[model samples]
Target: MTASEPGTPRTGPHRAELDLDGVRDEPTFLDRCARDLALPQWFGHNWDALDDCLRDLSWWGRPSGYEIRIRGWQRFRAAAPETARTAADVLADAIEYWAPRDTPLTVTFDDQE
Candidate 1:
């Protein structure tokens, strides 16, 4: 799964790329998500917090749609399969939450490093 990065600024309104090139644990994964996704300041940096933020991206003015591209995730998955599954599930849930509301949220994976 891959998509070209838009020419827009790396602010809250464009696709957020989380490059987990070396991330191998939940803590690092959370930190990478916070930085790459530009999560809100009030973000609690936890699984629950991540779910809440992804569900409501008001911080980004709740764009008409949202896309998240995950790159270099192979290492993380191999290092910690369980956490990787949980992370994928959370993202999937976020997509489900937005689909019914008309605001599509797509999560793509790009492990071709």
Candidate 2:
């Protein structure tokens, strides 16, 4: 059964309610990257660094047609020692900036289930 089917226990904590209409028509991975880059400089500027950290731990990305969800704390701790603390702090701040005080921002795939 589908995730929305009645009695299907939710597998994840936060539900990312993505509205395709709200997403761009010409959506692509690059478009998503660009939008992510528009976040606060502190967080956006470190995207590559954060990605490298996650890559090193085999935590980022997935095979085509699949989706992956990463925990912020896990990614934070995986960063290089010198940058880990700062990365975690910046991530916390960015999360607060992007989400409402009552709700959290949960990243999810836009093009796949």
Candidate 3:
């Protein structure tokens, strides 16, 4: 049965992809984020800025219950483990930021490349 089928439960997370191939610096990471999420021009390309935009994703008009998957996550991790950890933490923060509303937003790092 399809997701829209009446009997099918709406229990799955919406999937989005963020490519991190050859992204080894802050600027590239920010650019990738902006492109992946189609963030606004006001994004400041910093962690706090990222957090702000992430929390404000209602502008995308996307429904609740979504998990954005960062593809080639291992590339980022290999190039800069600390930065990768920071990204993961920020995503976790975003998840928490929306949890109170029962939106079920989250992110997953996929190392499959």
Candidate 4:
């Protein structure tokens, strides 16, 4: 049964929601993820570090899955296209890594203004 199916226990699909309303740089992006996602102290504030943390969310709790929803990134993408691409690539890799695992990972970008 799917997660939303009735009678299914809410063991989870733990979520981390990030609102980047005014953020437009790599530092801010990393800082936002580290702060909003409650990344561990070992997080090194870099793309590699972000990738590592996204792949290992055991610290966030052992949920059935994970969903990272990002909103208000149009401005960031417009301001820093390269950085946004890199961030997207890392997130995509994390999703792929978890797709075949028991605990899946998903990232959604909300383009609503």
| Candidate with the greatest lDDT versus the true structure | 4
Task: Provide TM-scores for the models.
Answer: 0.84, 0.27, 0.80, 0.87
Residue-level lDDT tens digits of model 1 in 1-113: 12224563343334789999889999999999999999999889899999999988867654557888999877889998999999989998998987866457888889886
lDDT of each: 0.82, 0.34, 0.78, 0.85
Q: In terms of TM-score, how similar is model 2 to the real structure? A: 0.27
lDDT string, candidate 3, 28-82, tens digits: 8888999887888999999999999888875555454666888888878889888
**Tens digits of lDDT, candidate 2, 5-76:** 455343333322322222222232223333433322233334454443222212221211112243233323
- Highest-scoring model, TM-score: 4
Between candidates 1 and 3, which one is better according to lDDT? 1
Candidate 4 C-alpha lDDT tens digits along 1-113: 33234565546789998878778899998999888888999999999999999888878666788998899878889988998999889988999988988789988889798
Q: Is candidate 1 or candidate 2 better by lDDT?
A: 1
lDDT of model 2, residue 35: 44
> In candidate 3, which residue ranges exceed 4 Å CA deviation?
1-14
Worst 10-residue lDDT window, candidate 1? 1-10
Clashing pairs in 3: none
List candidate 1 segments past 4 Å from native. Answer: 1-13
